[model samples]
Target: MTDATAGGPREVPPEQLHLLTEFVGRSRWFGGKGRPFQVVGVRRLGRLPACADDGPEVAIDLATVGFEDAQEGSGESGQDYYQLPLAFYTEPQDRLEHAFVGHFEDSDFGVRYVYDALHDRLAMGCWLRSFVDQPEGPLRFHRIPGHELDLDTHSTLFSGEQSNSSVAFGEDSLLKVFRRITPGANPDVSIHEVLTRAGSDHVAALFGWVDTPALRQEGQTEDQVLTLAMLQQFLRTASDGWDLALASIRNLYAEADLHADEVGGDFAGEAARLGEALASVHRTLAEEFPTEDRTADQLAELAEGMRRRLDAAVEVVEGLAPHADRVRGVFDALAGLDGVQVQQVHGDLHLGQTLRTVRGWKIVDFEGEPAKPLAERLLPDSPWRDVAGMLRSFDYAPHVVERSWGDDEGAQQRAYRATEWATRNKRAFLDAYVGRELTPAEQTLLDAYVADKAVYETVYETRNRPTWVGIPLEAVARIGES
Candidate 1:
C-alpha cells in the first residue's frame, strides 16, 4: 500500500515560498521554465545528521511541482518531483554565498537561511558520513565488499555538468546526487556495480549508493525504491576523450602540409582502442545480464515507436519534416529484420561519456538517455545503439573545429581534412568493434540507428541551439543519400 496524498503538507514554511520558486528557476537542474508554475508540495524523504549544533542542518526533499500546460514540450508534467538537498542555517556562511538558495521563516525552527549543500563543507561532511558510517534506517547507504572508503577525505563539488551534482572526495571517490530522480534501479550505479565487481577495467568501480524506501507522494510509483545518490571511484587522472580528440583535430588543422594520418597527434589508434574497450564492456554486460532474441514482429513494434517520435518531432522541429519520409524508410527497414540479439547496454555512448586513461579507454555515465522511461532504459537493446551513438560522436568532433573558422580561404580545405579525419577514425573504430566486417544486414541496422540518433539531434538543436540545427540537418541529408 502506497500513501500518495493530494496537496501534501507544507514541508517548507509558507511565508518563504517565493524564495524557493526563484531559486529553482535560476538553477540549471530545474526542468520547468517558460511556463506558469508553483511548488505545490514538498516531501522531505530523508535527512542527514546536523554534524554540528552551531552549524546548518541538512535535509533531502522532493518538491512536487506543477507546470501548467507542460505536456506538449516535457512529454509528462503537471506534478513532477525534483530532488533538492538543502542546508538550513541560522547565519549565512561567507564561503557558501554563491550557493545561497534563499532566506526563509520556519515556524518549527525559527528564521532559517538556506544554501545548496553540495557547496557547504560541513553539509558535505554529513553526506560523506552517511556513506562512511552506513547509517541504518529507511534511508541506507550500501557499498560493495573489499573496497575501503577513506573517511578523512574532504569533499569538493564538480561545477561543470548540468544533469546531476557530483562531489569528489579528495580524489579517492565521487558521489553523484541525482536531481530529477525516477524510482527504480539506477543503471548508473547498477551497471557500474556489475562491471566493478567483475573487475572490468573499462569502467570506474562502484563504491556505494544511497537509497530510501519511504514514500511516493511525489508522482509515479512504478517502483517503491528511490535511488538518492551513487558513489564511485574518481578517475582524477583520466582525460576526457572528446577533449583529446578535439586536440588531435586541432593539431592537424594547425599543420600546413600534414594530412590527418601524418599528423603527430593522429587519434585513429586511440579511437580503435576505445572501440575495443566498448566491445569488451558489451560482452561483459551480456554475460552478467539477461539477453533475448527479438523477432521481426518485435522489431516492427520498435520501428513504430521510432516513427511516433519522428512524427512528434516534426511538429516541434519544422526542418525535420522534409526528411521525415526518408527517415521512416530507414526505420521501416528494421521491420524486415529478425533474430537480433538484445541485451543491457550503455543506453547513451559518446566521446563525452568516455575517458582516456593511462591504462586504457574507460566508459562512464551508464545512465541512458534521460528522456526515456526507466523501463525502456533498462530494456535490452541492440548493441548497435551504443555503436551508433559513438559513431555520431566521432562525426561531431572535427565539425566543431571546422565551425570555428572565420572567412578563411582554406575553409573548404579544412572541411575536407575534417571529413578525412572523421572517416579514418570511424573506420578504425568500426573495424575494432565488430572485430571483422559488418554484414549487409548489420550495416542496415547500424544505418537506421545512426539516422535515428541524427533525427533526435535535429530536434534537440532546434529547441536548444537553433543556429546549430543545420549540422544535424546536413547529416540527415547525407544519411538519406546513403
Candidate 2:
C-alpha cells in the first residue's frame, strides 16, 4: 500500500498501512466488519493532470485478502478487494467547481473525494473520454454538428444519495454511476427500463444505460467494463417513503381524539392508493415476465430460513419462553399453509423505498437489501412478501418514534395513536388489495405471510437494532393473542 497524503505518492509505511486499514474498516460505507484484513498489494494508477483550480487526482488499486493463511480468529476467507474502490482528489486552493461542491469532505489526507462521475465535470469528462474512443452497448452520443467535444470541460455531477453517484446536464439528460457493480444487469436499472418503456406511471422513467463487454480489470484496464451508469428523468420534488409515512402518522396522531371516520390526514386513503399502485405494478410485472409455481421444495427452503431466523430471535427474547408454544404454533400453521403464488415481487419493500411527489407515491430502489446476493433478490416470490414488508413498516414507524422520545408516556401515547392509524390504514389497504373479494384460502395465505414477515422482523431487530426488538417481539405475542 502507498500513502498519497501531502499531494504526492510514497510507499505506505507499516504504521500508515495499519491506520488506512482501520480507517476503511470504520467507514459506514465499508461493508465488511469483524474480520481480519491484510493489504496484500497496492498499485498507483497515476495522477490526473491539474486543471484550472482543481489539484491532481490520484487513483489507486488496493488488493486485500481475509484469512489467507487459514488462521483461527481470522475473518471469512476469499473476500475480494475488488469490492472496495477509493479515489482521492487534491487542490492547491480549496475552491472547487459548483459540481464538486458539498461532495468532497475534508480528511486527514487532503479532501477525501467521492466518485460522482456524472455530476463532477472532471470525472464526467474522464469517463466520457474513456468511453468516447470506443463506444460500448447500443447507445452512443455523437458530437453535435460544428461542435467540438471538450471532454475536460463538459462534465457535471448530481446531488444526493450516498449509495450511488450520478451526473447530469439539463432536464433531459442524466447518468447514475453505480459504485458497487455486481454481476448481471442490476434490477433497479432493468426493472425501471421495462416500467418506463411500458409507460408504467408507478415507476421512474429510464432513458438508457452504458456498459462494457467485460468487467474492468484493476490497474491493467483503462476502460471500465459492465454497466457504468444509467440515464433517467430525475424527480425534482420527490419525498421519500420514510418522510411520507412519518407525515401520515403525525397527522393521524394529531387527530386521534376525533372519530376514526372523521380524522383528517387518515393514511387509509393513501395506503389504499399505494396498494392499488402496487397491484398495478404487480400486474405489469406479471405481464412482462413469466411467473413460476411455488413448489414444495421452495416453500421448505423459505420455512427453514424463517426457522433459523426465529430461533435467533428466541435466543434474544428468552423472557417470552412461556409463549414459545404459541409462537411455534403460528410458525407451524404458516409452514403448513398452501396456495402460495410465486411471481416477481419486490424482495425488500419498506417506507424508505418509496417516494411521494406532487403526482403520487412512486416506488423506487428495486435493488433490494445490499447484503443479499443479486440472484436471490431477483428471484420470483409471493406478492404477499411485499405486502408483509409494508405492513412491517407500518408497525415499525410508531415504535421507532417511541424510542426516539426515550419511551416517554407522551411518546407511548403517540405510538398508540400511530399504531391505531396504521391498523386502520392497513385494513383499508387490504380492502383495496382484495378489491372487495378474496377466497378463504387467499385470506389464510395472506395472514400466514404476514406472520412469517413479523417473524423475520423479530430476527432483524434482534440482531441489527436490539433496542427496538420489543416492537417485533410484541408483534409475535400479538399474533397469538389476536
Candidate 3:
C-alpha cells in the first residue's frame, strides 16, 4: 500500500532520503557531475511483481536532482530525473557489499537491507521474469515475439557503460536500464523496434521494453509515457567499430613504408560496407517515417542554428576563434538551398556507435546527442548529419592514434600517414553511401554538416579533453579546403 498523504506519489522514507542523495552523487550514470547538485526529492514509483515466494522485494524510485548553477533560458529546468531500482532483503548479503544502498526498518518486511537492484542478479531475475510473464503492474513489459528468452540465465552488469547501466543475461539478452528519466517516447527503443520488425540486419533486434505512465507533475494536462528499460538481442561476438578502426590505424603505423590502402589491415572495405549499411537504414527510415523537403526559409533557419552554435563555441574553445569565420562561411552557404530532405536518423552516428558482428556492421544507440533534451533529439534531421558524424569519426581515429605517439621519432611521418588513412576511408565511405557524384547542392549540404559536426567536436573536446582539442581544430582548419 502506497501513502497518498501529500496529493502525490509516496515520498522516499525521510530517513532514507540521504542515502539516495549519497548514492546518486557517486553513481557513474549521474549526469550532474562537477556541478553543485543535490537530490531534491525521491518518490516511490512502484514495487515490482515478485519473482518468487521468498525472493527479495524490488522497488523503483525516481529522484529529482536540482543543479544549483544551471543557466537560465537554456530550454531546461535546473533539474533532472533519475531512476533508482532497489532490492530489499531481510539480512545484509555479504556478496552485495559493493552494491549496498542503505538499511531500513520496513513496516511490512521489517529489518530491510537495500541494494542497487541492477547489481543483484536475483533482483534482475525479477525483471526478466516480468518480460517473460507479462504481469500487470505500474511497469509494463512490452515484447516483440520471435526468439524465446533464456529465463534461467543469470544477469551480469556491464562496467564500461557511462550514461546508462546495462545488464547482460548470459550470452542471450542485454537489458539497458536508462538512468535518466524523461516523460515521452525514447527514440532508442522506438527506432530499434521499427528496424527489428522491418527485418533490418544493421541493428540489434529489440526484444521488449519496460515503460509506465509518467506521473503528471503540476501544470501537466495529460499523462506521458516514461520508458525505463529495454531488452534486446546481445551481440555477444560483436567487436566495437572504434576498436577495429584503432587497430587498423595501429597496423598502418607499424609499417612506415606502406600506405593505408596497401596495408593488410586496411579498413576501407569495411568502411564501404558500413556506408552501405547506413544508406540502407536511411532508406528504410525515410520510407517508414515522415520525411519532408525543407523550404528556403527552413534551410535558412538550419544555417542560422549552425552559425549560432559556432558563435557560442568560439567562446569556450579559443582554438575555434581562428577557424570561426571559415566555418561560418560554410554554414552561411546553406541559406540559399531548398528541397533539402530531412527524416529520422541516428542522431549521434559515430564509429563508437557501431558494432562489427560476424554478419556485418550493426549501428546502435539512436538516442542522438546525450547532452540534448529528448524533444530536440527526436526531431528530423538531414541524413548528412549522420554522414558528417561518421566522417568526423574517421578523422578522429587516426589522429587519436597519432596523439598517443606524443613527441616520438617519426611523428611527422605518422601524422602524414594518419591523414592518408582518414582521407582514403572517408572517400571509400562517402562514395559507397551516395553511390554517385554529388550535385552542387548536395556538396554544399555535406560541407556545412561536416563543418558543423567538427565545430561541435571542438567544443566537446575543449570542455571534456582539453589536450585533445587539437584533433577537431585541425579538422576545422580544413573546412573550406575540401
Each candidate's number of clashing pairs is: 0, 6, 0
In the range 51-82, model 1's lDDT, one tens digit per residue, is 65676887777776777776776657666667
Estimate, for each residue in 94-189, the C-alpha lDDT of model 3 and write its tens digit. 989999988986444467998999999889999999888887666788999998999999999999856999999999999999999877889999
Stretches of model 2 off by over 4 angstroms after superposition: 1-27, 33-119, 125-162, 166-175, 213-227, 254-256, 259-263, 320-323, 337-339, 407-412, 480-482
Q: Put down candidate 2 lDDT per residue, 397-446, tens digits, no spaces.
A: 75665566565556657766656766787787777866878775465456
TM-score against truth, every candidate? 0.92, 0.74, 0.96
- Best of the candidates, lDDT: 3
Question: The CA-based lDDT of model 1 is what?
Answer: 0.83
Worst 10 residues of 1 by lDDT: 1-10
For model 1, state the Cα shift of residue 445 in Å: 1.2
RMSD of each: 3.2, 7.1, 2.0
Candidates' C-alpha lDDT: 0.83, 0.58, 0.88
Model 3 pairs whose backbones collide:
none
Between candidates 2 and 3, name the one with more favorable TM-score: 3
